[model samples]
Target: MRIGLYPGTFDPVTHGHLDIIGRATALVDRLVIGVAINRDKGPLFTLEERVEMIESEVAAIADRTGCEIVAHPFENLLIDCANDVGAKLIVRGLRAVADFEYEFQMVGMNRQLDNTIETVFLMAEAEHQAIASKLVKEIARLGGDVSKFVTPAVREALLARVGRA
Candidate 1:
């Protein structure tokens, strides 16, 4: 069985993320959504909350796409997480050249850690190239509706996290 790892902070899962997940699922037997716990970049939601949000979003997607979603929190290196999950591939979504630069560096680092695991980059849909969790949070915090960008669970979670409608 081919397994792929999709790692990200996922402050809140957005529709763009769902799109990537849906697309990535077609390339692998199972997709593990790894939530990286980054202390350097403070997150709007806690790890548990992020995991719950991912689970909710994944469950909804699975209902529609018939794909299996697994959520995990990783405080260690991403390569280590992939090893732990027995995944041989890391799936990433590329929004632009900027995203490629960062993801390329990560891919190299992961390759250094484990030469067997490979990173696969998928281009994000044109409409979602500019959608990011930080931007979503900023817009939602400023009273701008992000219902179109994120899933309903994420929208509610963001509203409760920021204490707004």
Candidate 2:
């Protein structure tokens, strides 16, 4: 089975992230959404919260995708998680040149860690290209609406995280 791992902090899985997940599903028989644990970045949501958000967001189309979708937390090296999950490809979403540059470096490192697993990049659709988790949180923290960027559940989660909900 062809398995692809889409790894991210997914602090609050935005629409752009979900879009990439949907598209990534089309390229593999199974897509595993790997929620990375990065305490150094001080994510607003807990690991469990992030996993639940991705799970909730993806559930809408999981049944019709022709691909199995599962979200899990990864605490170790990403390549190790990919290997453990039997992922032959590491899926990444690039919003623009900046994203591509960073993702490119990571892809090179991932390849060095395990040459057998390849990295695939997906460009974000124009409408959702500017929506990022960091910006989403900032908007919510400042009492702005993030409904357009995230699912209803994730929007609520973000508000609650900042004691606004």
Candidate 3:
């Protein structure tokens, strides 16, 4: 079985993320959405909350897709996490040239860490190409409506986090 690891902070899974996840599933037998517990990123939601929200958001279509997507939290090196879950491919989404540049560096580092795992890049859907988690958080923090960028569950979580809900 071809397993792919889609690793991200997923502080709050957005529509853009779901777009990537949806497309990545078509290329692998199983796609593991690894939520990284990175403190440097200053996530808005706790790991458990992120995992729960992602599970809720991905559950409906996870089984319908040719592949199954499992959401889980991991606090170790991404390569290690991928190995733990038996993933041979790492899924990444590219929204723009800037994203490509950033992901390019990480891809090199990941390859250096583990030559066994291959990295696959998927371009984000045109509709979601502009939606980013940082932008979503900033808008939510400034009391702007983030309903269109994120799922209803994620929007609720963001609103509650910023005390707007």
Candidate 4:
């Protein structure tokens, strides 16, 4: 069925993320949003919260594109997660050269682990190139407006998380 896996922490799903998720629908019949449970990163949102956010954000896109979107939380290796979801393609969003450099290395390592699964990179739109979840959280923590980077619902969630709401 041409399932694809797009893995991310998604502490708070940003507009940039939604852009990638929406675009990814065109390449696969089902796109599984893998919400990584990286305790080392100390994510702002819990795995359940992240999954809920992804599911809420992608609902419209799924309806519009006629693609089935589901959120799967994983604490294991990304390649293993892909296999669990029956994904032959791993979709990644690239923001800049710096992102590409890291992703390139990941692709090499992932390929060595499973040559059958291919990784596809989608460059973020120019407007979203500068939007990152880390930066967004920082901005919200410092009492800055994040309406430009996230949806209103997400902005509210961020604000509440940072005690701004």
Please tell me which predicted candidate would have the highest lDDT against the true structure: 4
Best by TM-score: 4
Question: For candidate 2, lDDT tens digit of each residue in 24-112?
Answer: 98899999999999899899888888888888789876787878999978889999999999998999898989999898888889889
Alpha-carbon runs more than 4 Å astray in model 2: none
Candidate 1 error regions (>4 Å): none
Off by over 4 Å in 4: none
Model 1, position 69, has a per-residue lDDT of 78
User: Which residue runs does candidate 3 get wrong by more than 4 Å?
Assistant: none
Tens-place lDDT per residue, model 3, 41-150, is 98888889989988899887787785788887899999999999999999999999999999999889999999999999999999999998999999999999999999
Clashes of 2: 0
Clashing pairs in 2: none
Q: How does model 4 fare in lDDT?
A: 0.95
Residue-wise C-alpha lDDT for candidate 1, range 1-165, written one tens digit per residue? 888999999998888898899898888878899999997889999999999888888886676666677999999988899999989999999998999999888888878889999999999898888899999999999999999899777898899889995
Q: C-alpha displacement of 36 in model 2, angstroms?
A: 0.6
TM-score of each: 0.95, 0.96, 0.95, 0.99
Worst 10 residues of 1 by lDDT: 60-69
Instruction: Write down the worst ten-residue block by lDDT for model 2.
Output: 57-66
* Cα misplacement distance, residue 105 of candidate 1 (Å): 1.7
TM-score of candidate 3 against the unseen true structure: 0.95
Over all chains combined, what TM-score does candidate 1 have? 0.95
Structure candidate 4, residue pairs in collision? none
When sorted by TM-score, best at the front, the candidate numbers are 4, 2, 3, 1
